[model samples]
Target: AQSVTQLDSQVPVFEEAPVELRCNYSSSVSVYLFWYVQYPNQGLQLLLKYLSGSTLVESINGFEAEFNKSQTSFHLRKPSVHISDTAEYFCAVSVNQAGTALIFGKGTTLSVSS
Candidate 1:
């Protein structure tokens, strides 16, 4: 079986500060890791993903995450976040290349303050 777990449900941070959101998974086989951000009522947008090869991956919007095999974790980090970065972040996993249905966690809300 494959499952994803997000350790934190919320992370409140002031604007321009660094942040980290923890994500862990349990899978019998290799899988794909993905981080998605949801702005308010909007749908989720892909923040980053780890497919193959490198254990580290980055997003265009300034977020990055490293895949840890032994820990079965993929935690997201950002050096500095803006108020606009406030959103609900979801961690997901897919078993194989099909990558069709993604198993999503409850979500971690990153509340960026001014």
Candidate 2:
């Protein structure tokens, strides 16, 4: 079984500032890590994922996450955030095999203020 934990419930940051959301996981077998963002009243959108090849993966919107196999961590970071980035972020993990369900974290609400 695999489980994800988001250390913070909420993160408040100013517009254009950098931010990092911590995520940790535990799994007996190899797994795939992912980051998803959900806008208000909208479904989750895949931000990034660590499938294979590289330990670090990045999204188009300035978000990046590195897969640390030893620590079982995949923390998300943004060099500069925007007001539009305010939303709920989730860290998820699933078995490397297909047809497995994703186990998500509680979620971290990112509030970007001016």
Worst 10 residues of 1 by lDDT: 95-104
Model 1, span 35-74: residue lDDT tens: 9999998998999999998998999889999999999999
Which regions of candidate 2 deviate over 4 angstroms? none
lDDT string, candidate 2, 1-114, tens digits = 788999999999999999999999999999999999999999999999999988989999889999998898999999999999999999999999989999999999999999
Worst 10 residues of 2 by lDDT: 61-70
Q: What is the lDDT of residue 100 in candidate 1?
A: 63
Clashes of 2: 0
Task: List lDDT for all candidates, in order.
Answer: 0.93, 0.96
Q: Model 1: residues >4 Å from true position, as ranges?
A: none
| Candidate that scores best on lDDT | 2
Q: TM-score of the candidate numbered 2?
A: 0.98
